[model samples]
Each structure stands twice: as C-alpha cells, then as structure tokens.
Target: MLKSRLYELSLFLTAVAIAFSSSEILADNTSFITAIIVFWFFSTLYFRLRVFYKNGNTNIEYGISYDLSFVLFAGPLGLFILETIYRFTVYFYRKWKKIADPNEFFDTFYNIGTFVITNSFVYFLFQHFHSSFQSFPFGYWVLLFILVCISSYISGAIMVLLFGTIGESITFKEGIHFIFKDISFLDYGKVAITNGLLFLFLQEGKWEMIISLFILNYIVNLSFYSKSQSIQNKLERDQFEQMAYTDFLTGVFNRTFMDKKMEELNQTSEKIGIVVADIDKFKRINDSYNHAVGDKVIQHFAATLKGYLSEDDYLFRSGGEEFTLCLRKRDFSETADLINSILRGVEKNSVEVEYNGEKTSIFYTASFGLYFYKINELTSIEKAYIQADELMLQSKQRGKNQVSMVNGLITKELV
Candidate 1:
C-alpha cells in the first residue's frame, strides 16, 4: 500500500512539472493556441467514441482524443489545453445528467500529463535536429513522421507500464511484452494515414479540407463504437446460452444439454455406449440427515463420477441422485472395466456433514447399468434409456452397488 501511494505521488509531481513547462511554450503561440482550442472544443463535443481492448490481464480504453490531437500536430501546450477543455466539458455534461464520475479529475490529470510529456519530448527532438531536418528531401518527411509517432508511443507506454505494475504481480518487462503483443501494424498504419492527411491539409492552407477531415474523423469514431457494441452484445448472448445449458447444482451438464446432445448424435450412424447410474438408497440419507446433507452428497458423487470420464465422454445430471454417462467409440466390453472402477471408488469415498455442532461421516454407494447400440438400431434415445434403466433395476434386485449389462446379445453381471 505504501509503495502504491509513493508511485502516485511521483506521478503527480512529474505531471505538475510538465504542465508548468508546457504553459511557457503556449504563451509564445497565442494566436494559434486560441484557434486550436476552439477546434478542439467542437471536436470533443462531436466525437466522443471509445474503443476497449484487453491487454494481457488488464483492460484498456482508448478514445479518439489522442489521435485527434496528434493529427493536428498539437505541441505540449496545445495538447494540454485541448484535453483540459474536453475533460471539463464531459464532466459538466455528466453532472447535468446526475451521473458525474468522482474519478474524472484523476483520469483527466493523468491524460493531460501523458500528452504533455510525450509531445514535449517530440518538440525537443525536433528543435535539436531542426538544421538537419530542414536539409531532408520532401519524400523523407514520412520517415520523420514515423520516428515522431514511435517516440510518442514509447513515452506513453512508459507511463502505462509504471502504473500497470503497481499493486500487481507483473514485472515491467512482462507488462511491456503483454501490451506490445496486442499492438498491431494496423495501429501504426492508422496513425500514419491520419498524420499524412493532416499534413496535406496544412500544406495546402485549405481550411475547408480541415473541416471535412474533422467530419470524417467523427464518422470513423462512430463506426468503431458500433462495432465494439456488436461484439460485446454477441459475447453476452453466448454467456447466457452457456448458463442455460449448465446444471446449477453439481456444475455438470443438465438434462436440457443432454437432450440437445442426444439429438445431434442421432444424425450420425456411429454406435454410442450409454450408462445410467443412481445413488443407492439416496432417499434414506435425506431422511436420516437433512436435505442440505443430501445435496452435498449428490454434488460430491457427481464430481467424483465426472473425473473418470475420458475426453470423448459426457456426464449429465439427469435427475436427483441420478446421472447418465454417454461414451463414444467405446463398446460394452471396454465400458465394463471403467464402470467397475467407478463403483469401487464411490464405495471408498465418504461425505462428511456437520449437524448440531457435531461432525458426522456418511458413506454411500451407487448402481450402474450399461448398454451399447448403433444409432440406426435404436428408434429413439427414450428407447435406449428405458433399456438401460430396466437393467439398472435388475442390478438393484440382485443386490445394491453393482453393474448389470443387457444388450440382447450378451447378459452379464459384475460385482
């Protein structure tokens, strides 16, 4: 906690120093500063779009503000003034709607500081190499523009790395690696194109071209917002579908999913092995203890049974104290050994419950019935289910905790 505070304090002090230095530069370009501020205010009011990206373990939100300011070649002071006005405008709008964010100032200060520092560095480099830069050919301006964009990116990245590593378990190097992994060539291309267009308009001294570009910028930002919303909505729908198919109690597939999967399997001609298992005397445990303990027992049993299944196997909680396992590409002979192992594992495992401040241990067992047939051989899943259930009743009649197999061709009992 102390380290986090220290980092924040350092950030504030650096931002303050940069703000003071940039203000001095702005005083010299008063006419251009006023014109740029007016342009920035309208741009901020018009283009309020944000794109979100997941960076490793963190999520980052980007707005068009930076791109807009960069394209205008807004030096440290102009960039700082533009962002300050934009932030204030947004705060007031939200406040009028009675939804003001308390953290707005913190974000505003950080962003202004980042812009000041990055653009200041770019200005400094340009001044230092102004003589050599003047000697460069017109075609070489592209190379200079690329260098400026890279420097700005690196400067902003340093701030991100510093803050991202605070209160987290990642190193600076790892954070850089993760952040850069998401940065693509397209990002650079966008920056280059915007910078080129801005430069062209400024060279031609065409105010109308600048106005047209501003409109295009707004449209591009709107397109990005629409795309992000569509992606987010699709993800939400997929999540809801997953929840609908999942069992709330044992975290296994529920009856709805089981039925859906069976329907899909019916379309194929391959044979599938089916096993229906039930907890032996499950109602007695509920009567002896309580419903809570009974639920725990069912959960434990379901989890244990699921562990023995292969990748191609599916386990479903079809009903209370009852589960169905569907195996693909496995015959009755192969399933027999697997069923016996599960029966033994259950007999050895016990569920512990607490009642009236006293700890009690409860033991339980399960019965299984296995059957296998080609999809063409079975008329429907209900017919296969009836055959497996009847065989399970026979196992219970012989004695509890056993597997019974009846496939019309072979009848076997395993104890």
Candidate 2:
C-alpha cells in the first residue's frame, strides 16, 4: 500500500513539473494556467487513487495511465477531454461490442498505434487551443502530429517485436527490467518523448534544443524500457499463480479454483446450483482399451457437455472420469435436459482410432448428478457440492448414463 501510494505521488509530482516546465518555456500567460495545471494534475492523481483503492486488480488499477506524463495532457481541460473521449470509446466498444481496432495490428501492435494516435491527437488539439502557438499553420500542426504519431508507433512497435504482450503493462518499478525484456519500446518512448520535446524547442527554431530533446527522448525510453521488462516478468509470474487455480486440460476451475469460486458464490444474493458428473465405467474403458484412447474419450465427453451449457454455467473436470458443472440460473429441469443432451451426444458420436494396425471406433458415455441451493441461505457451498456428489454416485447405482437430482425435488431416469 505504501509503495503504491509513493508511486502515485511520484507520478503526480512528475506530471506537475512537466506542466509547469511547459508553461515556463512558452512564456505566455493564459490567465488561469496555474489553476488549470493544479486541477488537471490533481484530478489525474485523484483518479489514480480511486482506481487503486477501488479495484486493486493490477490490470484495472494502473494499466492505462501509469506511464503517461503530465506534459502529455497539455492542460487540465485537455486532460478531461482526452480522458472523457477515451472512457466513452472503451464503454461503447464494451457495451455494444462494435468497437474495433482503428489501427490494424495484433496484440502489442494495437496498443502501440492506440497510444501514439491518442498522444498525437491530444497534442494537436492542445496546441491549437494555445494562443501563442497559433502562428503555426493548421497543415503544419497536422504534419507534425502525424510525424510524432508515426515515430511513437515505430518506437512502441519495438516492444511488440521484442516481448509481444509483455510490453503492454509497465510500471516505474518494472520499467528498469524492460531494458533486457525489450529495448524497442524504450527506443519508441525515447523517440516519441524526445520528438515532442524537440518540437517544443524548435518552436523558437533552436537547433541545439532540438538535438538535446532528441537525445533525451532516447535516454528516457531506454530507462523506461528497462523497467517495463521487469514489470512484465512480475505480471507473468502473477498470472502463473492465477492459472494454478485452473484445470490444465479443460481450462476451467480446478478443485482449488472451485473452492474459491464457491466461497464467493455463497456470499452473493443469488442461488448457486452444483452439478457433479462421472463417466460411466471410465475405468473399464482405460482397462479394456488404453489410457491414450481413454484420454481422447474424456476430451470428446467434455466437448459434448460444453454444447449443452449456458454462458453462465461452468464446467469442471474434478478428476479423471469425474466432472462438475455449476449452473447459475434455471431449476433442475433445465440442468437435467442439458446434462442428458450431453450424454446422448457422447453416445451418438464416437472417436475413431488406429490401434494394433487396425482402425476402430471408440464410444464414451457419462452420468450426471446436479443439485441447486439458495446461495443467499447456504452456510456453506459444500452442502450443494457434497449432495451433488452423493447424487452422482446414486446415478451410477440406479443405472449408467443418467442424471440424478439431489435437490429432493426433480430427478431424471438414466436410460
């Protein structure tokens, strides 16, 4: 917590210095310049604080504006305008799902283009608003914006070429390790930052300032790039930890994840239903055929089951031959039909394999046990899970390849 706060303060302080320095260089009084900087920088810091406080998720809290500096904002009003536009763009894309990459590139390429375009546009608009900078032609301003955008794209693209998705999220601490991970992003940031600074210096047609700014951009990008690599390593390690909770073969919750998710669902207002399933005579298949064939049968069984499920429902491989499904809505009927469809699908479809110099078809089948309980009322989610497990065992006893309900209300015949 202290570390995050300190980083936040550093960002705020750095941004403030940039803003003040820019105004000092301009030597133009726009009446309310000081107030604007205070408002803009503070507002940015405030948003950053709120983000860290509310969503502590690393991806959500600092991924967006962590690297951006104050000079990038131009002014408080400019900051507000850019943020509002970016936020709306994000919300619209997510809400309607119509938003797409304006620039076509895969992975880190997309972010490179996005960041460059945003910076160029913001700088262009902010410059146009400045009365002192009005001497420059609109076309000249546009040309400069395009140049800077292109430079940023190329430089940031370095990160893409080097580390791929690893370059996307870099904090100050991580910026150091970026040196070894991908120096391209460093070059990119350097060129972009320096180019912008050069443009500012060349406003007075000073050759030395232009050269100095150019060098500065390179140095800065190199430094940040180093940190970025370090950060990427940390993030990757964290993601590894997250994946530990997920099943390797199925890409769903493992027992560890299931326990955690069930705990969360127990605290919710809505009810959660737990369904347990097992492949009928799975051991016989492995014994009679082979584990290799058995594995294919398992994959086929899981794939069929996936088709019957709703988006909200979850599928899990509890162990070899044993499966679990968590149904969010719907009563036993819906879950029953879905599970039954999966069973029928598995029965109808067979995986063909060549063994002992002969080609043959392999069939797989499963039995399901499902139960639902009010999530709001459950003292524990284990109640539903245990009952569902017992019900699954009961299905094996009643007959193979059928769904049994443990909720005491609805049950289905296995045949």
Candidate 3:
C-alpha cells in the first residue's frame, strides 16, 4: 500500500506536539550540568561529521549526546533542549554544506520525539525504583543503568517502527528485523561504556576524563566507518563484475561468460555436452507484432530453457534469438532427455502482450542441436560449437521444432 505525503506530515506534527507537551514538566536548572551537556552535544556533532553510518534507509552517526542528555539531565525538559540543539546543529551544518535533503527534513522532529519520550519514561522508572541516589549501592546503580539503556533502545525501536510503517508501508516485522540488524553490539557497548564512564567521572568530580573519553569514542567511530566503507566497495565491485557477464534483457549468462566457462572446462579431462538452440521464426514474430512483443517471447523462451537445466548445467543467451547450454557429467540419453524437455516446454508456453489496450497471446517453439565430446584442449570446444551449429541448421531444415543430435560426431535427427 502507498502512503500519502499529507498523512506522513500529519503524523510528524502530532509527534512533535506530544514531545513539546512532555518537555513542559522538566525542572529548569542552569548550572555546570547544562554547560557539560552543551559541550558533549557539540563534541558529538564534530565526531558525526567525521563518520556517517547508514542504518536501514537512513544515515545516523553514533553519538554520546543522547546518552549524556539522559544520564546528566535526568529531567524531560533538559533532554528535550539537548535533543533540539543537536538536531538543529546537524540540520544547519548540512544546509551550510549544501547537502540538505528535503526527504529527511521530517527526521528531526521524529528523532526529537523519540528521545524525549523514551528518556522521560526511563527517568520516571528510575525515580520510582530508587529512593535516593546517595544511598544506592554501586551494583544497583549498574542495574539501573542497564535498564535505562535497554528501555531506551526498545522505546526508540517502537517509534521507528511506527513511523516507518506509516510513512513507507513497511511491515512491523520488517521494521523490527531492520532495527535489530542495524544496531550492532558495538553500538550498544559504546553507549554503555561511555555513559557509564561519564557517570563515574561526574561522581568523582574528574573533569579531565571528558577529553580522554571523547577522543577514544571518535577513534572507535572512525574505525567502524572505514570497515563499512570497505564492505560497500567490495559489494559494488562484485555487482559490476556480475553485470559484465550477464545478459541484461534475458537475465541469463552472456557469451563472454560462456567463453570463460568453456576455458575452465578445457583444463579438465571430463566429457562435456553442448546444445545450441534458436527460436523458430523469431524475426517473423518481431516483424508481425513489434520488437516489444518479440522481447517478451525471448524472455519466456529463456525462462523455459532455464527450467530444464540441472545444477551442473549452464545456459547462455548467445545471440538475439539463440541460446547455448552446457551440460557436464551427463550421458547421451540424459542429454537427449534434457534437450527434448526444453523443446517441449518452449512449445507449450505462451507470451502475453498488450497492443493498443488489448491483450494478445502468442506461442513459439525452438529447434535444438546437441553435441557431446571429451574436452582435451580449447580447440575441442571450438570444434564442438561448429558441429552443434551445423546440426541446429539441419533441425531447422527438417522442421522448425525438433531436436537434431550429433552423437559421437555422427549426425542423427531426433523428433
């Protein structure tokens, strides 16, 4: 189902309203805590500029700003202010660099609402459980910290799932899967360790720990960014290599791939089988209908050929209306059955085309020529192709839809 832009906008506005309401209950305190929060927020922005990580459909940098806001402020109002500052800073930075994407403009509100709502609930739970932080044991403090992290993650995940489903028609299950997959253990560990360390520093009144932790966090973010970039580059290279060996129209192996496979086979001493086939009256189909309909017919024929191939077989779109199949470790009878099955499938299938608002169906068939031989050198493959091509011409001459087999270099016609 497609989602309307107006609906998405309405949802964003409603979320912003809720977050604003929640921020009204926060206690206003302007002191050293506020200054430290501001410093950490800007430091997060600086590290964010150095490393941008893609999570699901959005790019989000790992930062301690959210953790700092939740741990230091302990109030809804302060968390809201810190979240607003961080979001606007990132937004203006993108605008100044002329890299602002309008599609992502709504994310600022969504993220703010998520942080305010989740952290506010965590603070409420923390207050309910602990009578006073002064007398709380260290073990209890650690438990409370873990609870905050888990609850914050869950609440944020739910918000993301809700917004994603409303905006993009993504399923709840898919959203959950994406969220879990995107949040690596490293992300959780970084947040837990940094926030825990910062909490202890505040308790001990140690100001120097701030700079040390910031540098360490930045180095870790940089390392993750480099690893992700390397993986992305390798995937792109593999895609390009695949495209080079694939037929774009038919989605089958191309002539170049066939050549490479033949070369590989030449190095082995096993017997190989080759089948060359061409659609009967393919040019007539194009001339009568149109090139579009001809393409549909070709795609259907390719699918039919693919259905008859085994795991050890390879199919290639050798020409406009011609295909070549390579079969290994198959005897003459097995090869004949496979070739006959392909011919039968092609004859039974039909291609549907729409012309001038009306639908028409067309059926087509192909002629096959099979050659089997032992591969000793590259020339053996070349010779097999020549023999198969000649035998295919014989099948086309005998009839338009029959198999002509060259058994052990002996020409034989099979219907």
Candidate 4:
C-alpha cells in the first residue's frame, strides 16, 4: 500500500512538473486548447469501452478521448489543459455525488500524472519523426499507426507497474495478455483512424465535422457496448444460478434443482425412472473414519454413478448420503441392467484419502431403489419419489448394497 501511494505521488509530481514547463504554451493557443478540452470532456463523458479482467470481477474502462488528437494538433500544453481540468471536474463530480471514497482522491492524482506524462512523451516522440517523414506518401498514416502502437505499449507497461505497486506481481507476458485479452486490434485501429481524422480536421478548421464524427462514433460504440453488456449480464446470471443450484461437495445438481426438475417431469407424459441411491452404512463410515472420509466416499460414489449415466439422465445429491437419478429413454429391462452395472462399478471402486498421516483406501457400497412408470395425472413425482425411497429402505433391510425394483406385482432384488 505504501509503495502504491508513493508511486502515485511520483506520477503526480512528474505531471505537475510537465504542466508548469508548458504553462507558457497554454496562453499562446487559448482558442485551440479550449476546443480540444471541450471535445475531450464530451468524449470522456460518453464514449468509453469497459475491459474486464480475468482475475475476478474487476474492470478498467477507457474513453475514446480527443487527448491524443489534441497532442497531435496543439502539443503537450493542450494535453495538460485537457487532463487537468477534465479529471478534476470528474473528481469533484464524483465527490459531490457521494461516490468518491478516500481512495478515489488518490486515483485522481494518479490519473492526472500518468495522462500528462504518457501523452507528453508520445507527443515528443511523434514530433521527433514528424518533420522528416511528413513529405512521404502515406507517411502520416503510418506515423499515426506507429504512435498508436507505442502509446498502447506504454499504457500496458504503466498498468503492469500499477499492479506491481498494488502487490499483484505478474510476468510481462501475462501483463500484455491481460491488456489485450478483451480489447481487439481493430478497436485500436479505429482509435488511430479516428484521432488521425480529428487531427486533420482541426488543422483545416473544420470543427463542425469533428462534432459530427464524435456523434457518429458515440452512436456506433454505444450500440456495441450495450450488446456486450447484455452478454456479460447473461453470463453472470447463469453463473449465479448455477451456484445456487449446485451441491458444493459433489459438484452435481442439489436438492433445490431436483425439486424443480421433478415438477417439470410431473407435467410430462414420458416414461420415467426415479432412482433413489443411498450409500450403505454411511453413518458407520463417519464413525469409523471421519466426515472428511465420508464426504470423499460420497463424492467417489456419485462420480461412479455419473459415469454410468446416459444423456437423458439427471443426477442430484438430494441429501447428505442420498442421491436421486432421473432416467429416461429406457425400458424396464434396460434400466435394471444399468442399475446392476452401476452397483458393480460402486463395489469395484474405493476412495483413497489421507487418514492420520497415512494413505488409506476405504471401500464402500450403495443401495438403490428404482420406481419405473409413465407419468399420468394420477401419479405425481412426489409420489414416485416416495415409492422409490421406500424400495431403497427395503434394500437396506435386505442386507444393503443391492438394487430393488418392482415390476407389476413382482419385487426383484439384484446384488
């Protein structure tokens, strides 16, 4: 935290130094500087693209500002005027709205410093080559592209430095990847072309065209930004919903999702197999070992069951040691065969866990009860589930580790 504050302070001091050195140029081009600052304010207010970082829910937004174009037309003093006034204005506005925390003030200082320094350096770099290459064919556009690339690199380096100061140390390659992860080269190209055109128009005294270009660019960018925001919102909603409906330990659908699916299945006329599976002697496992071992055994058992399921099957961890599987697109015989195969699979598997500083393999088994029937108005999913549960309890009574199912009046048990 101290390092970040000091880094911000250094940037603030350097920007102040640059601003004072160019104070004399500010008065010489008052009208031009005012025009640039006005447009810079407008762009800063409305035209920004949000780039999301992969680390978490953090994002950085950048505007399609006229600052770079101002540097091209009116030099470093123009940038100093634009950034100093515009950023402070935003700072005060955020403060007035009760949104500016203590950190925001420091961020404002950092912004003023970095914008001035980076743009001033870019201005000098362009000027160094401007005179020699101005007469060449397409040299101006080429120079603009080069300027854009170098500025992007500088911006990325500054970001890496900021992360380092904040204790998020990253490799240069990772920093570059983070910078270009969401933003495309085409977006950068558009900025280069837009700023390049703005520069030419400012030179030719066609200020109305600049306003028109700003409006057009804002409209197009707003459309795309709205679309991107919609997609991001949808993704977040899906992730949240998935988390709410998932079992944390087993990574399967939980009881909440199971209830929802059961209601949907109740409304359908399809032949369904509601299978209730419970780990045999789960209490004994916890008593002999620990809850950690019990959880491991449950997870391994759920995984084995999942491996035997088809596309039309949905598995849910409906209780601590109980799971429910909804099986479809299979007849009675096929369902029995699948359940027996799952029983064999569970019997063959063992959960390996570290117990008392020693590697231990705990073998376990499960009992299953399958209620197969076509859904009708008279038969509800809750009723079917209760029937399956009763059959599963019967399996437990019949020495456990077996599947019990009823076909018509005959009750069959598979061990």
Q: Please give the CA lDDT of all the candidate structures.
A: 0.68, 0.55, 0.69, 0.79
Candidate 1 lands at a TM-score of 0.70
lDDT of 3 by residue, 106-168 (tens): 666556666666666666666566555536567545545565566556654755655565454
RMSD in order of candidates: 6.1, 16.5, 6.2, 3.8
Q: Model 4, 72-105: lDDT tens per residue?
A: 6766766776777777787788788887656777
Name the lDDT value of residue 103 in candidate 3. 50
lDDT, residue 363, candidate 3: 88
- lDDT per residue for candidate 1 within 1-415, as digits (tens), equals 4453455456545755665665353323554565466466555656447654554433355553333333235456565566667666766776788875454455455555555566566556654665676675753354446545555476557556555545456676865764454556566556556555764565455557766776787787688778988998999998898899889999999999999998888788776677899999999999998999999999999999998998899999988999998877777677777888999999999988887689988899999987777665435655676678877888898898999876533433221
Clashing pairs in 1: none
Candidate order, TM-score descending? 4, 3, 1, 2
Candidate 4 wrongly placed segments (more than 4 Å): 19-30, 47-60, 131-138, 176-182, 407-415
Model 4 lDDT vs. the true structure?
0.79
Q: For model 3, where is the 10-residue window of minimal lDDT?
A: 1-10
What is the C-alpha lDDT profile of model 2 across 15-66, one tens digit per residue?
A: 3443344433222334224423333343343332222222122221222231
| Top lDDT model | 4
Residue range with the least summed lDDT across 10 consecutive positions in model 1: 406-415
